[model samples]
Target: MTSPFASKLRTNYCPSDEEVAEIKALLVEPCLRLKGLDDKITALQKALDKLTQERDSLEAYVQAHTALISPSRRLPLDIIQEIFVACLPTHRNCVMDAREAPVLLGRLCSSWRAVSLSTPRLWASLHVVDVGRLAPVHDSSSRRLEERAALIPEVTRTWLGRSGQCPLSVSLYTFPFPSDPVAPTILETLIQVAPRWQHIQFTIPAAFLDTQFQLAAKDVPILKSIALHQYDPFQVPNLAWDRLEVLRGSNVTGVAISGCDLVLPRLPLRWTELTALSTLGSRDSPVSGERHISSQEAMELISKCPQLRTLSVLFEEHGLFAETEAHPIVHPLLQTFHCRGNVSTFTFLPGCLSLPELKEFTFLVHLPGSDAYMDDENGRPLVRFLAASSHLESLHIGISQFSSSFLQEILRSFPPTLQRLRINAMSKIMWGARLGSSLDDAILSVITPGLGDAAPCPCPALKELQIDRCTAISDSALLQFISARAATLKRIQVDFAREVELDIRPSLQPFIETGLDICITHVRPTRKVSAWEGLPHAERPLLD
Candidate 1:
């Protein structure tokens, strides 16, 4: 609407008292109209707020009733129990952790708790760690220790009680202390349920085996597997050895079980009935006093274990070939054999025994001296053994001080049926000399198949290849090997001791796109120089 003061409205003009009165009169009409519109907006906002509140209340009511018929709540009791069982860890026995199942399942709701409690399999296996004297004890702490000691037995009893008639797999460890009062109580409780034990492992001390530990042959009728740690072989509980299928000998924790700590011949195990055996305790850090069986003893153990399918043992370096050179023991059912020792262990492979049905083989030569593995002579026995095992699928060799020719001969002996090959050329050093690695480009070229259709290759069906500390293997040879076997190769892992100067990813990208798994790692280059970089005035040095 046009007004007389329209020109003055936007200008910086101060109005007189008479002009101001007239402007106020004109503004009164619009101000009353604006007040009326404000009243209408306030009423509409109140109605909208009420409608939103009602909608939210109705939606919440529907959701509340819908949850009553939720899929988990409506699931059958058996199905719910199965779901709970699936939540349990498959790798290890169940621990008393509320953060995990079956304890976690019990914390969800009353129905889930009931289902978890009623399921026998959920409670069939348990791993209990008794903190014993390791728990600090002083005044009030001493009382807490006694309370915890008393509570563990009761908790274990209740946990096992839920297992109805199901077989039990139990692992009990007592923190390397025998004087703890709680360990004996737990041991007593476990012995009471020995009939249902299918697998049992103990990492307790010798004192626990004295008067507290008692198990008759009749008590462990269903026990199939047993692992004894820290106890002397002589003091080990005399179980039903004939029925046992698996035996594992662990390291000496407290004291040497016997004079040599696990002399293979002295153990009271019925070797013929066993299917799997492992005596090398903690391969990364082998415990002191753990004895390695002689070559003769290893052969003797193999002959005794007719039904053995897997054997992992450490052998000594010295043995006479005249003992078993003529007649090699032939096993029909043995499949996997893992041996660790010095040069003699590899030598024993050919002279000792034959595994016709062998599928997997691992030989680890540790701490080879200057004279050991210097030539291909010791590796010839390994080639003979590999030739005899027609069904071998996996081969793992870890050694140091190996010559290139020795490793080449070993690689050539790999059977066509082999699918997994792992070679670890450990850093070689003897006395004051640093030895060179045998795993070089030449060795990789041997396995890399030719482009010719008729040309043969080692491990043609190889799916996995792992080479560690092969600082001599170059990027070109590694790529050639992978490209030649890309059709069957699924995983390739190569670790170099020296830093990789070239990036091999561009060449490997095509295979990676086709779902090939490749892992290539190398150490970082260090700013290191030779000890005697400068000579005596650029001539001969004073030091020898």
Candidate 2:
């Protein structure tokens, strides 16, 4: 049975004629055996292919039926609706996107769609934007766009109709296009349901505010809160001012109606009934001198409104000439006060106010120039105000700079109930000047417990600490501060002003594992340039 070519099996040697003839004679029986084996394998292969197709069909059939008996299919409608409701965006109104919740829930299946559509609360809130803003600019079909815009009225009407008489929460934004009648038509449709407007935000132009809102006053019977973004002189929509509890506006001062100048608070809103009022200026341009109140006017509102608990006002220097020293006015019911804007105007604010029940106070001072007008040392008036407010539980200070003595005195004045403290400062480079800021290791050491003998902790009940833009605090000081306060501190958030080379996570891992929330971020340092280097290069042409 041995073949002569066995020696050359693994070699490249060629066989001679006698050896080739011997190899061919030896392969005849094996060739016949190989052909018979191939036929047997072909039959088995066909059987395997048929069995695989049948198994795949059975698996698909079983999988299709298994979904019918899933546990999710037995979920109660109320429970399913609650789960669907939880998927909504809490911070903002729902948008018209299939990729997100309310809309996405409808596309799940027939049962889910029926539940979502039947739930009136799901369609009660909506954020509407003009189709022109969302349509692709590359699309050259104006007729199609016009038709799309024309459908807004119908779509809005249908959406609102699904609410089933529920109070509506809506935010509408429209760009200025007088030729397009869609915004006006949308406004009209919204006006028809004015009675159901529980909360709304409007960012329309001046013309719509003047024309449509004039007739909307009587219709908005249950409207309790409204925010306006219009800046032009327009009459107050004769809403039920007595019933309105909350009012908010941005850059909405110096409004004149029929040629009479009146500030926002000076408007004939039932000042006594308003529980909350915010006239925040736009942050895009902080010093625009648009929407702010003087210290005197703030005092007037505080003294006039007995039920007012929360007031946020931006202060500027334009209204400083009229105010002089006066006796402290006591507000018994005010709990939260947020005052920001120019620091110069904040000088007289603390001198004339006494908020005995104030629990939370935020003073974010924006330094417009190199100096604060408070000639008195260490913010004495402010310290006195904080000292008198024994119920203060939270205090937030954001200034361009802080003197060490002032910060220490304010901290010393904090009550034992103060549970939260946030200190933020802008870098000196932001103002293009070098100024003295006291947020350093020394100040942090002051707050760190057990560091000094017999030095009482400022806020013993403190549970949260947030510090930002204080570049002078080192890693060791921050770590020690967190370690000392680890028992009481539940949350710690710090944004280092410069790059941190050390990873402090290993040192604080034990505290984090024990349920302490921690977040640390670093700001990348950029190359510093001098005034001369920032000047235009000699090669570029100058502008006219």
Candidate 3:
């Protein structure tokens, strides 16, 4: 039997060799199919890349169309120019370093730059700062100053030339004192075209007087306003400024009365002219010498200005007094008088109070630390003079001396035509107290006579009340007053009060129910309660 089995194995009787080949072929068929699948995958990836490119192209086209269809893109060129000019800053700056303005307009499109360039008013105002920063070459600090000085005039001329005959308002500020001397040349050019100049401001150092005077003498009759900063007052030369209406002085460290005197004769009394004068300095500053304008000089100059309506006289170390026996009267047409100084007592000499047309008056009296005029009989005459103004509608009185009697006299004497009343920094007074108990009581007594027949009722015609930094008003008394007079009250504003416990809600509830306006502002005294949230709706601001 073993011999028979060996013979069969040698003969390969189970299956033929061709059957094995067939099995191998079947396994290889699956490998071939996998290779075909990989080829198809590569093709699909290529198709995906093509689709992605097409999608990106479509998105870019849509963005372009959207931008073109925007309303801003459709605005007329003139309107667009107006928008650009509106973006210019009104605040005066010595230098403007930002380049985004013209550049941005230029980059928008060719048409925009054309429109912007054509609008002369768009370029008439020029402000330059740190001209040295625009230099192409690095130089020593001193050299940079020289280069900046030389470049200033050229830059100004270029801007003005582009502006054509349009009026120019130029502000030039530079530092380190340039040796280049271009500013004078530019100013000379401006003087030649003086009629085209409307406004000019200079913040240059005091060393540039010669250049300034030369330009000022050019008789810029069209110049309406001129402002000088950090310059000698005397260096300002006289000109035929028939159209000049406004003159301002800033950072004036040096006083040259000689120049002012020379220019005074040229200033005529034109009814249309209005002047705003201001000076600032400490009592000990050297600038005080130049700041003095004698009463005689002031009167003489003002007499020529018959049409003058508004006058603001501010003095630091001095006061207006009877300097000359002439005692020239102020313009009869004057309507507003605002004066501030250390003078504790000022008497509007017999005819000084002749401004019958005066409407608004503000007087700030600062008492000397050891002065006696605040308490003496000397202030009586001044008080009487102020009380006699019949046309005064708005009166603001600030006193350094806290005297109930003095304040009471003023309130009792004030003109009945008054409409607006503001009291600040007053002492506290008890409600229903005696007249002499506190200054506040005196004030209330003076005003009570003008109110309704009731004790605390406000003036019938009074519409607005503003109280600040005053601790004298009692909550109950104020509430009683408002509740009785809420029909006439329109608006009330309070800030920074000392009495935090005063709850005005009960008194203001009537106004809120009737839809009248009321506003009250105060700080939280402690973290115990939310004062703002707790306030009544009428006293709280409406939020969106």
Each model's RMSD to truth, in Å?
A: 11.4, 9.4, 17.4
Cα displacement (angstroms), candidate 3, residue 521, comes to 9.0
RMSD to the native, candidate 2? Answer: 9.4
- lDDT (Cα atoms) of all candidates against the true structure: 0.73, 0.71, 0.53
* TM-score of candidate 2 relative to the true fold: 0.73
List model 2 lDDT by residue over 245-345, tens digit each: 22322211211121112256435555667666666633322221235667777888788778778877777665346345679888888898888866555
Q: Model 1: clashing residue pairs?
A: 232-257
Where does candidate 1 have its weakest 10-residue lDDT segment? 250-259
Could you tell me how far off, in angstroms, the CA of residue 83 lies in candidate 3 after the best superposition? 4.6
Q: Among these predicted structures, which one has the highest lDDT?
A: 1
In candidate 2, which residue pairs clash? none
TM-score for each model: 0.72, 0.73, 0.52
Q: Encode model 3's per-residue lDDT on 1-544: one tens digit a residue.
A: 2332355556647755885576566568678888999999999999999999999999999999999899987898778878887766577522323365543565667877787677776677776543333343566875666665567667666667777787767755443333343545555655555667566655444445333544332355556555444333345443333323222222111111212222444433232354433232222223221233433445554565566566544434444355433343645776766655444224333234456777777765543342322332445645665556667676666544535656655555566566655555443233533222233433554454344233433334556666666556566555555565577667666554664566878768878788656666666654443446755764644443
Each model's backbone clash number: 1, 0, 5
- lDDT per residue, candidate 1, 52-108, as tens digits? 999999999999999998887788888887888898899989998799988998997
Clashes of 3: 5
Displacement of the residue 91 alpha carbon in candidate 2, Å: 4.0
Off by over 4 Å in 2: 1-67, 130-155, 174-183, 232-262, 282-289, 318-325, 373-378, 427-432, 436-438, 452-454, 525-544
| Order of quality (lDDT) | 1, 2, 3
Candidate 1 overall lDDT versus native: 0.73
